[model samples]
Target chain A: MYEFDYRRPNTLDEALEALRTAPDGKLLAGGQTLLPTLKQRLANPSDLIDLAHIQDLKGISVEGDTLVIGAMTRHAEVATSPDVRARIPALAELAGDIGDRQVRNRGTIGGSIANNDPAADYPAACLGLNATITTDRREIGADDFFTDLFETALVEDEVVVAVRFPVPVRAAYMKFKNPASRYAIVGVFVAQNSDGVRVAVTGAGASGVFRVPEMEAALAADFATGAIEGIAVPQDDLNSDIHASAEYRAHLVGVMARRAVAACG
Target chain B: MTVTVSMTVNGEVVSGEVEPRTLLVQFLRDQLRLTGTHIGCDTSQCGACVVHVDGVSVKSCTMLAVQAENAAITTIEGLADGERLHPMQEAFRENHGLQCGYCTPGMVMSAIDLVRDRPDITEDEIRKGIDGNLCRCTGYHNIVKSIKAGAQAMKG
Candidate 1:
């Protein structure tokens, strides 16, 4: 790993100040992805502003019909939180199945969505449940948050404070995971609410997490597994790798969406 | 630049000056001479460096030594009580849960954390709980048995 200065700030203002002072600085959340990236020399930052010490950034609460999860709240906390389970059990299950137990203990919701890995699970939930990402500067809707693979709408100095997820009437996420990494080869999150039905696809998208309008329209009409069985995402826009072909991922999307719809029932 | 990091390890408060890039596993083995924590794969994929930080299991190799500042850590060395083996360790010995022994330390550490609160943990849960720790030897059959036995023994 490259040499760097480490600063643990007690408050958001101090962290922001540190980021400004160090020109090339990275905010260290759970460090699940950042630490590994550093070890491989993929990134070089002059300073690392650790966010673990900021007390206000760790919690889970429900406000109105939305669930507010603090940026630093770990995946394990989300998986086991009574509030999260009671309000959004599917979201809790998604959090529990990410990586593994140890990974869940350290990986946080803010970090997961901020990194926005194409194969990550949180983006699907964010998009499917209609989440609002509250940053140090402003609130960004989920549809506008994920821009590309490993990218987000966050500015250089901006910090993600919390994610506000509107509780859906019912939602379920199903993923065909890579055996080794446990990352989704093709994951689908299907949600039905009073607004309508939203079908979000992750891991298979070439751009990143995306919504399938055709599948959403089909599910909205019937709200059944068989209703969307024929609706398929095009292979041209899906990701293909050694683990699965674009055609296979396209096929899995239909399978997973159907399974997710069945799970929602 | 070097930073002074202090943390409670094995019930003893220890401090060391290390580079900001130094991993927690490196700090434990090189500076503190706690060699019991093995590094099977320097990458976080292998659970050979699993340790408890603030009563939760985490990959030590993925964490910076400085990140654990003022935290409570329990390594493989901290499990046994002076010549007497921990229940998990004893269960492993009884169940023949090891062959090459490279992955034993991590498996034991992860197993203890897995069964912390749950008394009647099922075999399927034990298999899933140790997903992070891989055992090339023993086929995980004995490891699963050992964790089940250990979970029962821990109830006492």
Candidate 2:
């Protein structure tokens, strides 16, 4: 790795100040993504502001109908938290299935959502469940959080503080994971809330994670696997790669959505 | 430039001044000479560099040594009680959990945390627990067996 200055700030204020002062500075949460990017020379930051020391960035809490998870909360914490599992079992299950134990243990929710990897699992949960992403600057809804491939609503120096997932009536996530990388080749998260039914697809979209309105409408009325039968997403909107074709991915969106609904049941 | 970091490693309080860019994995292996915590992939994909931070397993490869200041860490080297091997370690040996043994330490460390956190672990749970740790040799069959055996042994 290239040499760079490292600072471990105890408080978010100090960290934010350091980020403000430093040119091309990157915040280090779990380093599951950042470290790899650094090693591959994909990112060359002048300084690394380690956020692990900031106490406020960790922990999981349940407030009535919402599950408030700190930005820096490890995937393992979310996956295993009694409160999260009891309240949002699908969210917990989603956390548990992300990139194995080491990744879950080290990868933070903030890092995953921030990186916005097209194949990441959390974005689907965030979009499908209609979670609220709280940053130091302001709160962004899940619908607006994800913008495009490797893009998010967060601006530079705006740190994610927490993600508030409203307790859904029923929800589940299903993914066809790439065996080697464990990334989702095609994943779907089906959620039914008071607002209505929401279907989020990840690892299959060109614009990263996205929701399916047609599937949502079908499920909202019936909430059954057969509700979305023959509902094919457009191939142009889906992702194509060595693992799967765009058409295959489009087909998988329906199949995975069905599985997610069945699992939710 | 160096930063002073104070943290507990395997129940031992240790403090040192290290280069700002030094990784936590380097600190444990180079500074402390705890070689059991191997570095398989420089990237975070391989679980060979896993260790516990405040009782949670994290990829040391991704974290800087300075990030661990004042934190509690438990590496594979600290899992045993001097002469006696940790149950997970013993189970790996008995079940042939490893082939090259490069990923064994990390697998064992992750498994220990998994079993401790969920005592009622099932086969599927065990499979998902060590999903991060990759063993190209065993195809994860024997590794799963080792974790199950270790969980049973730790229960007693």
Candidate 3:
């Protein structure tokens, strides 16, 4: 790893100040992704603003009808939090299945969403549940927050503070995971709420996580696994790799969507 | 740039000056000379570098030394008491949970944390729980048995 200045700040304001001073600074949440990137020399930030000491960005709470999770809360914490499990069991299940035990112990939701890895699980949860992402500067809806592959609406130096998820009536996520890394080869999150049904697919999309409107409309009508039985996901935009071909991914998306809906019960 | 990192390792409070880029595993093996914690894969995929940071297992190779500041860390060297090995260690030894033993320290650490979190961890759960740790010898059958035995011994 290359040499860099490290600043462990105790407050959000102090972290923002440090980011402002160091033009090439990266915020270290749990050091799950950033540290690996640094180790591989994929990134060379001048300074690292460590946010682990910030007390404001760690907790799980319920306010009104929404479940609010502080960004810095680790995946392990989310997986085991009673509040999270009671409010949104699907979200808890998703958190419990990410990566592995040690990875979950150190990986944060903020880092996961901010990185926007196409194979990441949190993006599916965010989009499927219509979450609201609150950053230090402003609030961005889940639909608009994820802009592209490995991208988000967040600009430079903007720290994601929290994510607010509306508790769905019933929701579940299923994935055809790559056995080695446990990364989603093709994953789907299905949710039925007051508004309607939402079906989000991740790891398969060429751009990033996206909703299947047709499947959503069908499920909204019947709210059953059979609702999306014959609805074919277009293969044009799905990802293709050694793990799975684009056609296979498109096929698995339908299979996973049904599985998620079935698991919702 | 060099930074001063202070943390409690095993039960000892230790501090050292290291480069900002120094990994936690490097700090342990080089500076502290606690070489029991092996580095199987420099990448985070292999769990040979697993250790307890604030009582939770994490990959030390992926964490910077400075990030462990003031944190309580428990490595393989800290698991045994004087001459008596930890129950998990004893179980591994008795069950023949290893072949080459390259991944034993990390596997033992991960198993301890898993059993500590859930004393009633089943065989299926134990298999899934140790996903991060890889034994090249493919000796997981014995490893799982050791963890089950270890969990029972811990209750005693």
Candidate 4:
């Protein structure tokens, strides 16, 4: 952790101004990831723009059929919010299961999605539920928002305002967690929305979180765990480490997808 | 770059000058001389530095001192009366929840927050609640018992 300037902005406008002033500045959300990255000397930014003080960037509200969660809304709030539980229980359950109780108290969905960690749980929910990410300038669809591993479509100094999650008819996120770190070894999010059935897989893909059209198509025909029976994601491009093999990850993807679909019903 | 941060800790307003990279845990243990919070891992995986930031349990090591400016922080030292131990601490003593006690401060802090959030939580919920606080001594069985008893004591 090298010495650098820290700025606490009380408003989004002030935060944006701070970012504009410091080109190499990094936004501090819950600091669940960013601070640890600094402690390990993995990254060194010239300045840190802390968004913890912005009151406007925190809240949960329902707009029509969408659940608009402010970017800085803590995971604990989302997990316990009555609106979230009543509207989308699966999303709330996913929020509850992320990291741990202490982590949930501080970690935010916006920070989770913005970081775009390959093993993170929020990206699967965002992409699977087809949530819309709203920035200071414009709104970006989840499909377009996530670009690569630890990367997003956000431009320089772009500030995330909120994420609009369209209430799904039925959705569930299931993950095979790595015991030690609690990161998803292979996580699958299955959703039945007005548009169609959508399935997103995280942790296993080499290119990061991705959609499985084949599972989606199968689930669309029959909304049951049996619908995706015998379906398997290819193992070649998946991640393989000491925790799990690529082949095992591909297998767990199928297992988690089936479990998620079953959990929905 | 040095920065000045002031915050309410254990009901006392404390101010300190520290580097921008100074962690909340470092500020408490080094500057404020509150040594109850431990730092087991710098990677944020270990919850030995868990503390309440504005009434929420967070890993202090993962938060900057500057970030916690003007926030209300409650460390392990704030949990009890002058002489009497907090119910959670008493439960730990009665149940022998710790062996080496290296992770006790963080484990107790996390447990208190867990009970504060969900008072009627079950055994499975209690197990899941303290997942962030890892005890290397493998004394989780008694720790779980302690939390359940502590939650009951909190009610009484």
lDDT ranking of the models: 1, 3, 4, 2
Per residue, candidate 2 scores C-alpha lDDT tens digits across B16-114 of 888877789999999999999989876677889889998878888878788888899999988889999999999999999999999998999889988
Candidate 1, residues A214-255, lDDT tens digits: the string is 989988899998898788788999988899999999999999
lDDT string, candidate 3, A163-230, tens digits: 99999999999988999989999989999987998999899999999999999999988988898999
Off by over 4 Å in 4: B117-120
Q: Give each model's whole-structure lDDT.
A: 0.94, 0.90, 0.93, 0.92
Candidate 3 chain B TM?
Answer: 0.97
Specify the poorest-scoring 10-residue window by lDDT in model 2 chain A: A97-106
Q: What TM-score number comes out for model 1? A: 0.99
lDDT of 2 at A30: 82
Can you rank all candidates by TM-score, best first?
1, 3, 4, 2
C-alpha TM-scores of all predictions: 0.99, 0.93, 0.99, 0.98
Off by over 4 Å in 3: none
Kindly list the per-residue Cα lDDT of model 1 for residues B1-156, writing each as its tens digit.
899999999999999999999999999999999988889975688798999999999999889999999999999999999999999999999999999999999899999999987879999999889999988989999999999999999999
lDDT computed for candidate 3: 0.93
DockQ of 2: 0.71
Candidate 1 vs candidate 4, TM-score winner: 1
Q: What is the DockQ of candidate 1?
A: 0.83
